[model samples]
Target chain A: MKNKRIYQVAEFMARVLTNGSKNLVTRETGKVMREALEGRIQSEPQGTVVVLDFSNVGIIDFSCAEEVIAKMMARLIQREYGDKYILLTSLTPNQEENIHAALQTKRLLALSLKGAKKPKYLGVLNPYLMDTLQLILERKSITARELADLTQVEINTASTKLLNLHKARLVLRERMSLAEGGGRQYVYKSLLEI
Target chain B: MKAPLSLHEGSFEYLLSQWGQRLSYPSDIVKINLRDTKFIDPFGMVGLIQFGRYLRLNGRNPFLLLPNSLDVLRYLDRMDFFKYVQNLFYLEPQDFTIEEKYLRRHHSDVLLEITSIENTDDVHIIVEKVRERAENILNIHLHYGPMEIDSFVVALSEICQNIPEHSKDMGFVGIQKYFYGKKLKKNVVKIAVMDLGIGIKESLSPKYASYASHWSDLTAIHLALFKGCSRYDDPGRGQGLTNVRKWVQKWNGKMVIRSGTAYTGLIPTWEFAPYKRSSLTFFPGTLVSLILPEKSL
Candidate 1:
């Protein structure tokens, strides 16, 4: 474990509405968000779970959402952020949609505070595959045979499901050598809590 | 009506294909002749609406020439093109009124009624409503992805926001969606944003004040449209139109920007140049017309 940190998004924006309906709208608003969090993002050690909080943010349009969340995630992708994790907390459905589409466009992934259910995987994912992803997240490691026995599905069905998740880049796959066997067994795990 | 303003697009043809040619025609009390216009696409409608708006701004009264075709008439009505024209020209819904069939989505095209954008929040609301209107036809009706919708939102907001920020006055923004081809496969989306305040030429003139005597509308606009050019004195300020230009290229969209006496267009290539001469009739404002076409799903 490196370090867990939290950052507020609205703090960086010029809060105009004294009421609860504050948001960012300008074309440059997203650049501001990314710039404000730059120092912290660079200083955070590897495997750090940096929570970008949007609790008070009432609304965020798609452009700003892309510049702030999608662009940020792309920059901090596991290969780029050096195993660092960026999780969004307190995201509204509308915000999630913008962020999801943005991330999906760039083929990036991030977790949310709600563990696995709240649009953690970009925009939307198949309901049928939710449990499989959750099982992988919780167990920290999984195999097709294990998922087949646990979910009461055929081996082929489990393998197909796992392969789909792998294709989405939501899970990491590794082939382990069997000491007394000629074949290797592939293991899968969640990118979450990395 | 003896003369209906013909849209002159597709099957129906007429007035002027080249915009410069239309300058030679009479401009007093502009009335559309749509009788021969068998089909009018979104681009055609936007062209007609923008022409009427320019004429009206220049003290010309405009009216609609309703086509005898009921479907075409209802389409004109639903597009809300009637709202901007003279109320006396409003045609009654006679035999053309068909019972609402099939979950019809694209209703009357919307006009934002000369909005006075005061702040970024106001900018957001106007663009939000515009996006909703576009979605009614673009996504919910035709199913374009969120990426396209989001781009429209950002581009429209940036342009409209300029009215309040740089122009310091009110501006108008409007959009309409229709099909282009005879088979109704080519989805066309048109958006127009105009402001009656100081034009870009006058605003950016100070940047080129050194050549005060030699300064022309063409030179001023070119400076502003340049990648890093800005009207403001600040160095970090000039990506508004740059971003818009990039979006147009990405979507293969076409845009024509008219400010002061000179106008320029942006396309995928730079093979063509904008009209370098001043117009015989001066438009004291800036008008931008954008056309975006989507593949038939």
Candidate 2:
């Protein structure tokens, strides 16, 4: 069960795209998202969950999808929007492909809507990454050696999976220096654990 | 100017002759005779509008010698061309009661007749109509994936959007289904747009002035195919051209861009494609046409 409240982006888009052209321009998408985010920031408290509603939008091009979802998620990540969570709801199959492709290109992640209270992970993930992510979700914080032992994968394989998760912006990694100066180790925390 | 300006889809000489005459002027008074021009298309419509605007800009008041053919006159009236030339030019339709004239009724075998794209609103209409034609047309049928048709629609919208966005002038888009290649002889969807505003050379001058000045039309077209080649610094800009190119390349389709005095054609063998001279002597604006295979590849 999630505690953060959700907001809809379609409310803002309803004000725009009155003609309903299947191919939406990038500027319109960007402008609508900015306005929606502005409203979300003001009315919602910290840790509030925002759901980008694509139910009304039937078609969106790559550039338009990039400007709206990928760029916005990147900006939020770059600025460290720690408490707030972004999810998507009512995505058509085509929209899912477009939004997923854009997010994958930029290596960003956001939760997807499964039901009223259910949020599902949406993005590219191989079986290995899936197991790694599941383990991280079970254990809030874990090191490479611990992940390797838990997954029964090689240390290098585990490290590679962590690095890939880090690249996908799904995991947070920090270098941990040994107390006796023996060596340095890395600690990875699943950002989705929240 | 008494020459017939139909410059029909396949008429090369007429286009050259009309364009040459428009460039050469001896007298300040301009009078054009459109009597014999019974059939009109988007290419001819753009030529007429551009020529009229050109005369007005040069301090020359132009008058139209009304067409002898009632069909031609009605075609002009239906297209809202009179609204453009009403104030500046001398036209015979003084709200005057002449013979009750109506355009000749004819059906084009193509998916769509030459259509005017005056605004963004027109883009939606055209895209929807084209999609409808693909669905309902008897001879040819297209079974597109969820995104395939949408991709084609977006690519087409980008082509039409160029008219209102960059042309800063009116233009026309004509989409049709036709056969291509003598050996293969396969049916394909053909889309053509004619614009009479600043050509590729002028549009790219902001960012590639040095290269544009020296580059021929074909060279400019080749450069235009690249992504991120737009003069504008705005994000999410300039990707459409690349997208269109990739779409064409995927199907090994054929695309030709003609502007200024040169033109370039892209065929299936694009890796070794070279820019070539166009059939026309001189064209004022750009004419971009492409042939996409019926089957998605």
Q: Which candidate is the best by lDDT?
A: 2
Task: Give per-model CA RMSD.
Answer: 12.9, 6.6
Candidate 2 lDDT over A1-194, as tens digits, reads 22444455565655555665544444444555565565555466654555666665645655567677777677665545544456677776656655665566566666566555444565556666877876776676788899888778899988999987665555567677988958999888754444
Candidate 1 Cα outliers beyond 4 Å, as residue runs? A1-15, A18-23, A27-194, B1-73, B86-122, B131-136, B140-143, B182-185, B211-214, B268-280, B295-297
Residue B221 in model 1: shift from native, Å?
Answer: 2.8
User: Model 1: what TM-score?
Assistant: 0.53
**Lowest-scoring 10 consecutive residues by lDDT in candidate 1 chain B?**
B8-17
**What does candidate 2's lDDT look like per residue over B1-297, in tens digits?**
664555433343354556466666667787776666666554455455555666787788877766677666665555555655666578754553335435323443356555677776677678667666555432344445656666676667667777776666667766655454563466666677877778776777777768545666666666777544666774445655666777777767767677777777666652334446644466656777766775733
- Candidate 1 global lDDT: 0.61
Using Cα atoms, each model's DockQ against the true complex is 0.08, 0.26
Question: Which parts of model 2 have CA positions greater than 4 angstroms off?
Answer: A1-10, A17-23, A26-30, A41-49, A80-145, A150-194, B1-18, B28-134, B137-146, B163-170, B176-188, B210-216, B233-236, B268-275, B278-286
Error of 1 at A15 (Å): 7.2
* Candidate 1 CAPRI level: incorrect
